[model samples]
Target: MNTKIYCLEQCFLPKNWELLLSAVKNVAGFCKESGKYDIPTLPVKLGHSLSKCAKVLRTKAIMEDNEDVKKSVEGFLKLYEDEWNERISVKARQTLYDAKFN
Candidate 1:
């Protein structure tokens, strides 16, 4: 995967699992590459950024081709579904409460 995948001005968290899986694959592939710095920081940086901005995300993206990068993305997907659901749940509750009381 090209490192330019991370050049987006906004987060890419598609609602569809397949697209999201493709993205996670890209990130995992990118993470496997050797960074110029002493430490491999892209994973953490990208993870934090996506987590911070993806709460209200609902968009689409073109899926990338399948690559050898698999294990980490699969692991993340297992946990990601739950985490994404929790964020959406919190947002929905807040919206409903605000609509009722505000």
Candidate 2:
């Protein structure tokens, strides 16, 4: 009965579906690389890329009617949300900036 659960029941065109899938893959790849790298400023760069990809998935989800595509978008949203929640603080950002400029 939940609206969020029901939203995934819709369908989408094949081309749009493909695009959504590609965005999901790209986001996943960025996430993997972000976790793999230990460089101080790497998360910021990867997060930026992930955010862009998440935005694409979000936009596609709004216009897509396919249940599969909706599910994929939902998964990516959850994953990225968790990643963002653990984002580096301003202190970390300052450290990265100082490291680059100093």
What digit string (tens of lDDT, one per residue) describes model 1 on residues 1-102? 232334332224222444443454454443224311222243345455565444322221113333222333443445465664453333334444555686
TM-score of each: 0.28, 0.41
TM-score, candidate 2, is: 0.41
RMSD of 1: 14.6
C-alpha RMSD of each candidate structure in angstroms: 14.6, 10.7
Per-residue C-alpha lDDT of model 2 across residues 29-91, encoded as one tens digit per residue: 333433322254554565566557656666776687555666665666565556443533233
Flag regions of model 2 displaced more than 4 Å: 1-38, 85-102
Q: Score candidate 1 by TM-score against the native.
A: 0.28
Provide the lDDT at 91 for model 1. 37
